[model samples]
Target chain A: MIEVENIEDQNGLRPDGRRALELRQIRVKMGVFGQADGSAYIEQGNTKILVTVYGPHQPRGSTGRSTSNITKGIVNCQYSMAVFSLSSGERKRKPRGDRKSQERSLQLKHAMEAIIHLEIYPRSQIDIYVEALQVDGSEYCASVNAATLALIDAGIPIKNYAIGCTVTLINNPSLEDEDNALGKGVLDANYVEECTPGVTLSVVALPNNDSTSKDGLIVVAQGAGQRLHLSQFESLKARVLYGCQDIRTILDYAVREYLTEQSLPSLFHVALN
Target chain B: MEEYPPIIVRLAINRIDLNLIKNENVQPRIYTPGEEISSQPDFLRGHGTYVDDENTLRASVAGVLEKVNKLISIRPLKARYQGEIGDVIVGRITEVQQKRWKVDTNSKLDSVLLLSSVNLPGGELRRRSAEDEQTMRRYLQEGDLICAEVQSTFVDGSLSLHTRVLKYGKLSQGIMLKVSPALIKRKKTHFHNLESGASLILGNNGYIWIGANKQDSDRSEGGFTQDLSRIPQINREVCARLRNCILILAQCNIQLTDTSVTYAYEESMKYKINELLEPEIMIDVSLLTHQRLIQQ
Candidate 1:
C-alpha cells in the first residue's frame, strides 16, 4: 500500500514536482469548432476536454416535450469519455450511456443551470456537450471549466465564471506532531495521488471579482475516497476556493485577449473612443 | 508517380498579433459576465445586463459596453440573430403548420411565415379562399428557401415574417453561405447587383445568397415562380468567386457590405477561386481589401 506520506517528498513537493497548493498548467482555446454555436478546448495538464454548446433555439427531442413551463429556458448536458481515454492502456467498451456518464451529465447540467440566466431566453433550450479526450484525474472539474468557456464563446448570458477545482487532504504521520492546527490539503490531485488513502473533494464555484471575500460561492461539491475530518473540511474548502479564484483570473485574461484579437477593425474606433 | 510531400510540425504559437488595433492611446473597456457595470441607480439597463440584489447593474455577457445617453448595453462579439422589425432575412423552411410555416432564420426561435401575408400567383388584390389554404404546401414545401422581412415579434420573441414585396419570396438556383450574423453590417439595402453580372443578397441573419441577375420580367410572376433553367457557365463561375470572397471577408472579421465584398472580389481576381480557401491567401486578399475600404 502506498502511504500518504510517500506522495509528498521531504522538500514539501508532491510526486508531480508541484507544491501542495499548486495547480497544474491550464491552456484554453475558444471557438475551436465553427459549426457549434459555442465551442472550447481545454488542456489541464494531461487531461484534455472539448466542450460544445448549442441552442437557446427551438427545443427538440426529449427536451422539447419536457418544456411545460415556458417562463424559463432549459439546460441539457451530456458527458462522455473517449474509448481510449483511460491511462491504464485498457480500451473501454462504450463511450457513453453507462451509469457513471449519466450521473456526470446530470451533475454538469445542474452546475450550468446555476450560472446561466435562463429566464431571459423563454421557451428555448441550451445544450452543452462535454467530451473527454484524455482523463488523468480531476476530469469532472476540467469539464465544468471548459463548458463555461464554451458558453461564453456562444455569448450566452451567465451570472459569473463557473470554475471547478479538486482538493485532496493527505494525512501525514510525520507532520502530525508539528503544529497540526491546519491540516495538510493539496490543491489538485493527479491519478497516482488520487489512489492514496485520502479524501478528494470536487468543487464547482462561481468566483466573483470582489476581494473582500476570499471564498467563492460554491455551486456544487462532491466528496470521494476516504472520509474527512470535520476540522480539516474548512481549510480544504478555503484552499479549493483560492484555486478557483486563480483559475478565474487566467480564464478572464484569455477571454479579453480573444476579444481584442477577434473584434472588427472598424468597430474599434466606436468602442475605444 | 508524384513525390510524397514532407510533413512539417511546429510548436503552437499565435500567428496573428494579439494587439489588432495599433492605436495605443485608446483602449476599449470590456466587461465580463457578473461584473458590475454601474452602481448608479438611475442608469437604465439595456440588453445584456441585469439588476442584482445589491441594486447594481451587472453585465450578463462578455463583450464591450455600449452607452447611448442613459441607456447602457453590452454587445457580445457573436450570438444568434435577434430580429428587428423591417429587417431583411433569408431563412429555410423547417415545418409546414396550419396557416403558418416555421422558418429557421438563425435566430433563437423559429420564425413564422403566414400564408395570408404572401402574394398569390394570379393577382395582388385577390382574396384568399379555402382553395388557397389547402394548397399552401404546394406553394412552399418543408425544405425551400425564402427571402422575407420581419413583420413583428410574438410575446415569446419569435418573429413573424412576410414576403409581401415583389423582391421577396422563394429563392431558386442560388448558393447559400452561412456566416456569423455580427459580421453583417446593417445598411439601407441588403440586395446588390454587382457590376460582374451577379446578384447578391446580404441577409441580416448572415445567410448570403449568390445567384444570376434576373430580368425585370422574370420578377413579375408574383414571386412564387421558380427559374429552373440552368445558369450559364460564366455566371456560375462569377457566383462561385463572389461566394469565396464573401467567406474570406467574414473569416477575417471584416464587415460584409456590397462595397467591401466588391473590393474583395476584385482583389482576389489575381488568384483562382480555390486558392482563396487557403489560410495565407485568404489573409492576403482580405488585407488588400481592408486597405482599399479604409481609403474609400
Candidate 2:
C-alpha cells in the first residue's frame, strides 16, 4: 500500500496532488442496451459500473419482503458482479450478496431512495441491478450515478439528486507524526486511497439542488474508523458536498446528452466496450 | 409509387465522442414471394424512428433508412423451423445423438446434422464403411463446423441437413467464438473474413471451428496473405490460439465472423479516430433497457 506520511501546506493538495476536493473524471452513457427500460454505464476514474432499470411491474415469485404500499412503486435492488468483474488478480466467482455486496446493496438502496419516487406508482416494483464490472474505489458513488441514469432511462422522476461520495480522512491519527490532516479533505477516494486504514465515510447527500437549499439532508452518511473528532467530520462533510456537486454536473450532462441524442457522446470506459 | 413522398428520419453526428450519432447503413435482403415484413414489431425505436403500422417501412424520423430485402424474424428458443433446403443460417449444437447432433437453429426444437450429410475429404461419396466413421470424427467432431443443406423439416420443426457438396464440409484454420444467437442472425452480420491469418467456420449450431491455411481459413483469402514468405509450418496450438483471439474479439462485441468479417475503411469513417471500441460507448442490447418506467 502506498503511504502518505505528511500533509502539505502548498495548495492543500492530497497525496495525488488533487485539490482539497477534486473528483476523478466521470464518464456516463444512457440507453446503452436494447432490453432494459433504462440502462446506464458509468466509469468514475478506473471504477466501471453498469446499471439496468427493470419494471414497475408486478412482483416476480413472492420471495423477498414486499412493501404494503398500494399506490407507490417498490424498488428491488440486486447489486451483483460478473464472474470476472473485480480488480483483484483472480476474478470473483460469486454474484453479489457477500458481506461486502450486501452492505453495498443496503447503502445503495438508501442512496437510491433519496432520489427515486417510490410514491408515484403504488403496488409496483422497480428493479435496479448494478454490476460492478470493475472496482477502483467509490463503488457506492458509481452505483448511485449508474442508478440515476438507469432511472432516467426508465423515465422515473425524482426529487433532487441522491448523489454519493466517499471521503477518506487523510489524518490517520493512528500514525504519530503522520502529518496532521494527512488524510485531510479529499474528494472521490479511489481504491488505492480507500484501502488505507484511515477513516472512510460514504455520504449520500441531497445537494443544494435549489442553490439556497444549503440546509440539505445528509441522507445516508456512514463511516468506519477509529476514534475521530467532530472537526475532522465537518471537513469531511464539506468535501463530500463538493464531490456530490461535481458528480451532479456530470450526471446532469449525461441525462441531457441522452435526451438530445448528442453526437459524439461523452466518453466512458465501460459502455464503449 | 409516386403517389406519396416517403418520410425519412435521419440522425447526424455533432460530436463523434457522444456516440449519439446515428447512420443510415443499409444492406440488401432476400424476400419470399408473399412474406411481408411482419406487421408486428417487437422492438423499440430509438429517437426519430417509427415502424409503420402496416408492416412496411420502419422509417427513420431524421436519418436515412436503407432498404434491404433480407428481413429476419426473431424466433423463440424452442420454436423449430425447416431450413429452406439452401438458405445459409446459423445454429448451435444442442445434443449429439447417435451419428447426429441436434442443433438449435434459433427455432422451436433443434435441427439435425447427420454424419452422412457431411462430405468426406479427398472427395469420396461412398457410404460409411467403419473406417469412414473414424475418419469423420477426425475431420468433423461432435462440435465441428460444416455448412449443411436443410434436407427436410420433420414433425416438430426438426430439420435434417445434407452437406455432401464442395461448399460444405469440415472447416479448418482461423478461429471462432460463441455469442447470443441474436448476434449471429443480426441482419448486417459480418462474415467476410477480414485481416485473416487463418480461416473460420460459424456453425448455425453454436460451435465455431477455425483452420490455419487459406483452405483452413475458408473463402476470404484476401483477408489472409499470399505473401507467406514461405509455407509457414502451422502448428495445431497456434491454430487454437487464433481461435481464442477471435473469440475474445466476439466477447468484446467487435463482430468478426466467417461471413461478415469485412474490414471497411472510409475517409469519413471515424471508427479508428474516435476510439470506438471503448466499452463505455457501445450500446449493448440488454434485457433491462426495455423498462419504460420513468422514475419519479
Candidate 3:
C-alpha cells in the first residue's frame, strides 16, 4: 500500500499530474439510445457511465413497493456495475443485486427526488437506470452526473442541475511551510488517491443560478474512509461545491450544443423573430 | 462460395454532421431546466414553466422558448405525446377492465377507451347490454392495435379515446413504426393514400402505420372483419419502401407530413430498398428530400 505522503509530489502535482483544485476531463453525449425516452453517456477521466430515463408515466406494480401514490410522482433508480468494470484487472462476481449497489441506488434516488418536480407528474413515475461500464473511482458521482443529463434529454421537468463531485483531504507532511488552506484538499480523487488514508467526501449538489446565494444547495453528502477534524469540514465542503459549479458549466454547454443540433430547422423560422 | 458482407466501422467524431443542412440565419433561443424565463409575475405559466420561491418563472425542461402573447412555455425538442381533443392516435390494448380498455398511446398516462364510446358491431344506435360488457375482449382483445380519436381528458391527464367513426377501428395486417412525437408535424389530415399504392397513418402519438390501401367495400363491414388473403408482392414492396422513407425523415429531424414522406420515397428510388439502410445513403436521400421541400 502506498502512503498518503506520496500521493502528491514535492512540486505540488497529484499522481495524475493535475493540480489540487483541477478536475479530470469530462465528455458527455445526450440521447445515445433511441428506444429510451432519454439517455446520456458521460466519461469522467477513465470512469464511464450510461444513464437512461424512462417515464413520467403510469406507475407499475411489479416492484412490490406500492408506488401508487395519488398526490405526487415517484423516482425509481437502479445502479449496477458491469462484470468487467473493476480497474484492478479482476472481474466482479455479480453485476447487480449486491449490498453495495443497492445502497448506491437508494442514494441516487434521494438525490434525484430533490431536483425533480413531483407535483406536476401526479400519479406517474420516472425510472432512471445507471450502468457503470468502467469504474476507477467516484462511480457514484459519475452516475449522478450522467443521470442528470439523461433526465434533461428525456425532458423531465426539474428544479436545477444536480451535479456530483468528490473531494479528498490528504494530510501533507512536506507542505508544512505553506498555508494550510491551499494544499490540504484535492478536488477529484482517482483509484490511487482514494486508496490512501484520507477522507473522501462525495457530494450531490444543486447549483442554483440565483444571485443571492454564492454557494449552491447540497442535496446529498456522504463521507467515507478516515475521519476528519471538525474544523476541516467547512473547507472540504467548499472545495467540493466549487468543483460542482465547474462541472455544471461543462454539462450546460453540452446540452445547449445538443439542442442546437437536434432542433428542427423549420421551427427556427418561427422562433428567431 | 458466397461472398462476405461489408461492415462499416466509423469513429464517433466522423458521424454525419446534422448541422450541415440547417439554415444558418435561423438561430433559436434555447433554455435549460431552472433557467429563468421571465422575472416578472404577470406572465402566465404554461406546461414547462413553474414559479420559484421568489415568485419568478423558471423553465422546468430544456428546450426552445415559445411565447404567445402573455403565455410563456418551454417546448422540449422531444417528449412523450401530450394528447389533445380530436387528434388521431394509434394505440395497443394493454388490459381489459369491467367497462374500459387501457390503451398505451405513448403518452404519460395510459388512455382509457370506454365501452360506451365505441360503436357496437350490430348497429350504430344499438344499446350496450350486460352481455356486451362481458364480451368486451371479443371486440378488442389484449395486444390488439386500433385507430381512435381523443374524446376528452380526465383531471389526471389521461385521455378518453373514442372509435365511433366508420374509419377508426381495429387495424389489421400493417407495419407500425415509432418515432419521436416532436418529429411529426400537425396537419389537416393524418391519413394519406400515397401515389405509390400505399396508405399511411401518421398518428399524433408518434406511432406510424403503413399498409395496403383499403377498398371501399371494407369500410361498410363495421371494420371488424379481416382481409386475411395475402396482399400482392408489389403492394408489400411499396409498404416497405414507405416505412424506410419515413424512418430516414425522422432520423434527420425533418417533419413527417404526407408531402415530405412522398418526396423522400421518390428520392430513395435511386437506391435499392436494402441499400437505403446505409449511413451515407440515408444522409443523401434525406438531403435531397430537404432540398426539394425548401424549393416548394
Candidate 4:
C-alpha cells in the first residue's frame, strides 16, 4: 500500500512532485472528431478524457422522445471508463454498464444541467458522452472539464463553466495546529492521495463573474474516505473552490485559443479590407 | 507482389499563431457563452444571443458576430445543419415511413422526404398507387444515399427534402466524407463533374460525395436503377484521389466549392493517393491550393 506519509515527502512535495495547491499541466484540443457535433480531448496530469457532444436535435427512439421535457432541453450524459484505465494488475470484465458507471453518469448529468442553458433548446436533447482513456486521479473533475470544452466546441449555450476539482485532507493535522486552517488540505489530489485514509471532497462549481466570489454556486459535491468533521468542511470546500477557479481560468483560455483558430482567415480578410 | 506501400507516421503541431494574426489591423471578434454583447436599445436579439437581467445582450455560443440593421447574432463556429429553403443536401435514408422517408442530413432533426415530392420510377407525372406505397422501400430503401433540395423547414428546425429534379436522387458507388457544416461554401450549384473523371457533390450540410463520372445515367427511370457495373481501375483511382484531396482541404478548414476542390485536386497530383494523408503533404497541397484560390 502507498502510504500518505510516503506520497507526501518531508519537503511537502507529493509523489507527482506537485505542491499541494499546484495543478497538473492541462492540454486540450477541440473538434477532435468530425462526426460528432462537438468533440474535445483533454489531458490533465496523467488523466486523459475524450468528450463528444451530440444533439440538441430531436430526441432518439420512443424512450428518448417520451422522456424529453417540452419546456426545457434534456441533458443526457454517459461516463464510461476505458478497460485499460485500471491501474491495478487485474482487468475488469466490463468498462461500463455497472453500478459505479451509472452513478457517475448521473452525477455528470447533474453537473452539465447546471451549466447548459436548457430552456433555450426546448424539446431537444443534448447527449454528452465522456470516455476516460486513463485514470490517474480526479477522473470526475477531468470529465467535467473535457465536457465543458466539448459543449463549447458544439456551440451549445452554457450559462458558465462548470469546473470540477478534488481536494484531499492531509493526515498531518499538526499543520492545522499552526493557525492556518487549510494547511493540511491538498488541492487537485491524485489517485494515490485519493486512496489515502484522509477525507476527499470533489466539488463542481460555477465561478461567478466576480473574481472574489469565494463560494460560487456548487453544483455537485461528493465526499469519500474517512469521516470529515463539520468544522473541516468549510476549509476543505474553500480549497476545492480555489482549485475550481484555477481550472476554469485554464479552460477559458483554451476555449479562446480554439475560437481564434476557428476564425482565422476571416480575421485576415477583415484586415486586408 | 506488394501493390501498395505501408503507411508512415509523423508528428506535427496544429497551432494557430495569434501573434501573426495580430499584425493585421482587423482581428475578428469572438464571443464565448455568457459573454456580454451589448445593451443598446435598438438592437434585437438574434438566434445566438439572449438578453440577460440587466437588458445586456449576451452571446450564447463561441463564434463571430454578425449585425444587420437592428439584428445582432453570433454565428457559432460549428453547429448541426440549419436548413434553408432551396439549399442542396446529400443524406442517407434512415427509415421509410408511410408516406415519407427519414433522411439523416446531419441536421438538428432527421429531415423528411415525402413520397409525393420524389419522381416515380417509371415517369415524372405518375399517379400515386397502392403498389408504389407498398414498394416505397424499393424506391429508396433504408441506408440508400440521395441528393435533394430543401423544400421547407418545420418550426422545430427539422427539414423537408424533395428530389424532384433529375440530378437529385440516389447516389451510387461513391465515397462520402463529412466535415463541419460551416466549411461548405454556399454556391449556385452543389454538383460538379470535374475535368478529372470524378463527379463531386458538396452537400450544403457538409456531406460530400465523390464518384466515378457516370455519363448517360438513365433519367427516364429517375435514378432508381443501380449501375453496379465494375468501374475501371483508372476511374476508381481518380475517385479515391479526389476523395483524399477533398478530405485534406476540409481538414484545413478550406471553404468547399467546385473551384477550390478542383484546385486542390490539381495541386495534389504530384503525390500518390495514400501519400496525401501525410501531415506534411496535406499541408503542402492545401497551401498550394490556398495560394491558387487567392490568385484567382
- Highest DockQ: give the candidate number: 3
Candidate 3 accuracy as lDDT = 0.84
| Candidate 1, CAPRI quality class derived from DockQ | medium
Best model number under lDDT? 3
Residue A2 lDDT in candidate 1: 55
Q: Residue A195 error for model 1, in Å?
A: 1.8
User: For residues A43-139, what per-residue lDDT tens digits would candidate 2 score against the true structure?
Assistant: 9988899999876544445722455565555677889876776676577868876887887787777666656556544555678899988888788
**Runs with alpha carbons beyond 4 Å of true place in candidate 3:** A3-5, A63-68, A172-183, A210-223, B1-14, B215-217
Considering TM-score, where higher is better, how would the candidates rank from best to worst? 3, 1, 4, 2
Lowest lDDT 10-mer window, candidate 2 chain A?
Answer: A262-271
TM-score of 3: 0.95
lDDT of 3 by residue, A1-273 (tens): 566656656577788888888999999999999899999999999999999999988765664246557768888999999999988879999999899899899999988898898887777889999999999888899999999999999988888888899888766555565465435678768887777666778888887655324434553434455667888888887788888889988999999999888887545754875
Interface RMSD to the true structure, each candidate:
2.0, 16.4, 1.6, 3.4
True contacts kept of 3: 0.69
Worst ten in a row by lDDT for model 1 chain B: B14-23
lDDT of 3 by residue, B1-296 (tens): 99655767789888876445765667788899979888888899998889987898998899888888999988887888999999999999998999999999999889999999998777788888899999888889999888999999999888999988878888887798999887776778888888998788899999998867653345665666666779898888888888889888888888899999999999999988877777788899999999999999
Question: DockQ, per-model, please?
Answer: 0.60, 0.02, 0.68, 0.43
The 0-to-1 C-alpha lDDT of every candidate, in the order given, reads 0.84, 0.53, 0.84, 0.80
lDDT of 4 by residue, B128-152 (tens): 8888889999989999999999999
Which tens-of-lDDT digit does each residue in B64-142 have in candidate 2? Answer: 1222243433111111122454545544454455677665453333567777776544445556666755454454445
Candidate chain B TM-scores, in order:
0.91, 0.44, 0.94, 0.93
Candidate achieving the largest TM-score? 3
